[model samples]
Target chain A: MKLNDEEIALRAGELGPLRQWAIAHQIKVGDYLGARDFVAVGQAHIMADTESLGAAGVDWLERWAALPAEHRLVRIPTITDPRGTDFAHAAQLKQQPWMLDLERRAIAAFEALGVLMTDTCINYQTIMPPVRGEHMAYGDTGVVIYSNSVCGARSNFEGGPSALSAGLTGRTPRYGYHLDERRLATFLVELSWTPRELSDWGALGGVVGRLAGDYSQVPALLGLDRVPSADQLKHFGAALASFGSVALFHMVGVTPEAMRLEDVVPAGTSLKTHDVGEVDIRALQARYAKDVDAVDVVVFSAPQLSLVEIRTLAAMLDGRRATIPLFAVTSPQVKPDCDRMGLTARIEAAGGTVLSGMCFYQSYAREIAEANGWSRLATNSAKLTNILGGYGYRPVLLPMEQCVAAACAGGKLT
Target chain B: MSGEIYYAAAGMGRKVRAKALVASDGFSARYDLDRIRGVFSRPEHKLAGESYQGRVLVLDAAKGGVATAWMLHEMASRGVMPAALVLNRANPIMVQGAALADFTMISGFDVDITHAIPNGAEVEIDPTAQRPFIRVI
Candidate 1:
């Protein structure tokens, strides 16, 4: 990797020990990916939930945090993904004391490093949306896919350590999605059906993701009858990234980069093409619904709920009462608006818990499942359904309305 | 005597010899692992019900969420993780995790590494080279 003067200085420990370590980390990753140079990134997002970090990761961060303030402060604007536990609702979720302790320690460490606790995967929706071709070091896969596809930003999956390094150094190794040639569509998907519901859109994403198979394949989708909403694309992109490890996608007419079919698709490029229809989405959802008639819990999360989604969920719960635990997780940025608009009240009034600043799966999900005896889970999030199986939950992927209905009938789906 | 050797585009960490756990499937520590049990727990995974602790995992590609970035370090701290990772192609998350954990990893192979290396074969990976490689001994 070619190092500029500033990078050379940082690597030589002229800047600080913190920066020296950061640059060294960047150089290693750059060398691995064959990055020719470093690209200046506008922002950085870190995903450091204690569930993923554990005690060792927290201790590692503390070691860095103990450095002098000037040495540890982030150079660029840095934010965080959802935390492992929302302190207010920790008891309700039944997260253990050790988990809460770990979350607190991790939060303190990040705060010392000057990272904002934005705690959101839907930062594109609630926070800053990057402009076309803007470079960023974003941690969450959902954030990377949405920003790259819809916002036309360039980023690879930076992860927690890499994003923090970029934040400290204000640049990242230029590779993967940062290169324009890699953005070209490698395949095509002809959609036979345009999904109406968010869950349907998510199911479509899961199907297309399975078809793409890996992070290297970018699929350009066509045949959409209308423009999908932000929330719809949110579910779709989140599920696609979760199921496939894909960082970027192009919707031929919907997304910014693929305004026309020819824009992203190279001239005369013979690409592998697949067709997705309503049955494909149904079949994908049915794969998660094996022998599940009763749900232990119903959650609307993964890529936390948008304001409009919150309103829609509140409306659905207005005249209904839930007999089982139903959780509606949203970001800290939107939680105030939900409260001011009574969306939160309406949701809580119907026996639902409106959690803020934390995603369910990231919040010690396995421990909570064990503490609550929650084996059967129902959610509107395809991403959650794809993730929770290994956590010992029988997760059922359903639409928002069906999830609400399941919550009302004491966890019975039928 | 030296056996078959395959060079990787890049690599990191120290050399080690371990039984190869070969699978032509993608890997994500968060999605396909039961961290407590030290096994592949995701039902749909090709290596479901198989133990992965201390083995060299040779897979097709890196897959799923960003949690694996921190998870490798966390898993390493608990002393329950693969001895090393050898992939045909790896996403940035896998590289980031390997870097932070200081774990042995070699990727970007010319051939399908999972198919080339047989499961249960004793393999040694030496990553301290300009062009790192793995060998079946």
Candidate 2:
């Protein structure tokens, strides 16, 4: 990788050991991914949940945090993804004390390095949305996919370590989505039917994601009757990134990049085209709920709920009483608004719990499942269903109304 | 076939020799692993219920979330991790994770590496070579 004078200075330890280490790490990644040079990123979002960043990762952060403030502070605006636990609801989630302690240590270490504890995956919706053509280093696959596909910002799947390195150095390796040529559609997806509900949109994403297969392939959708809302795209992009390791996608007409199919797909280019209809989406959702007639818990998360999503959920729960645990997880930014609008009280009045700044699967899911003896999980999130299978949960993907109905019917599918 | 060698387009970390666990399935530390047991725990995974510790994981692609970036480091700290990873394709998360943990990983090949290498075969992965490769030995 070609380094400029500033990079050379950082490499030579003229800045500090922390910056030196950050640059070295970035160089290693750049060399591996065939990056020719470095690109300046406007912002960096780090995903450092204690569950992912075990003892060693936290210790690693603390070592840097112990450095002088001048040497350790992030060069660019850096924020965080949803943490492992919401401290206020830790006891309620049955997360062990050690887990909480680790979380606190990780938080302190990040704070020392000047990282904002935004604790959100919906940062594109809550925090500043990136403008088209802007480059960023973002963690959380959902954030990367949404920001790239929906917002037209450029980013790869910058993980926890890479995002922190970008924050420290204010730049990332210029490769992958940063290159314009890499953004073209490798696979073409034609939609035979459009989805109405968020869950259906997510199911559509899952179906399309299975076809996209990997990070390198970008799928361009050709048909959509109307423009879907941001929240709909949120679920779709999150599920797509989760099910597939895809970073960027073009929606032909909906997204910023591909205003027309020709914009992403050159004229006369032959691509592997897949046609997805209502049955394909329904089939994907049906596979998750196959033998499960009932569930122990119903959660709405994985991208965390937007304000509008929260309001819709609150409205659905207004007149119903839940017999099973139903969790509505939202971002910290949306939580305040939910409170101000009495959405929180309405959700709680229906015997549901509203968790803030924490996602279901990210929050020590396996441990919580064991603690609560919850094996059959129900959620409206296709992404959650795709994830919880490894955590020993039989997750059923349903619409928000059906999930609310299940919560009211003692976890029964009816 | 025992002495056959396959080269990778990109690689990092030291060379390692271990038994190969071949699968045509994708890998994600958070989505497909039970780190405590050091086994492929996802029921849908082809290597489900199989121990992955100290083996060369020759798999299809890197799939799913960013958690794998920190997970490789965490798994290495506990001494529960693959000896090396040889994949047909890799995502940034996998490359970043391998970089942080200093874990041996080589990806991008002329053919599907999973089919090239047999399961449980003794293999040597040399990432430091001018042209990184995995050899059946």
Fnat per predicted structure, each in turn: 0.79, 0.86
> Which model scores highest in TM-score?
2
For lDDT, the strongest prediction is 2
Stretches of candidate 2 off by over 4 Å are none
The lDDT values for all models are 0.92, 0.94
RMSD of 2: 0.7
Docking verdict class for candidate 1: high
lDDT of 2 by residue, A1-414 (tens): 999999999999898999999999999999999999999999999998998999999999999999999999998999999999888888988999999999999999999999999999999999999999999999999999999999999999999999999999999999999999999999989898999999999998899889988999999998899999999999999999999888988898889989988899898999999998999998998888899999999999998999898899889998899999989999999999999999999999999989999889999999999999999988889999999999989999999999999999999997
User: Residue pairs in steric clash, candidate 1?
Assistant: none
**What is the DockQ of the complex in model 2?**
0.92
Q: Over the stretch B23-128, how does candidate 2's per-residue lDDT look in tens digits? A: 9999999999999999998899999999999999999999999999999999999999999999999999999999999999999999999999999999999999
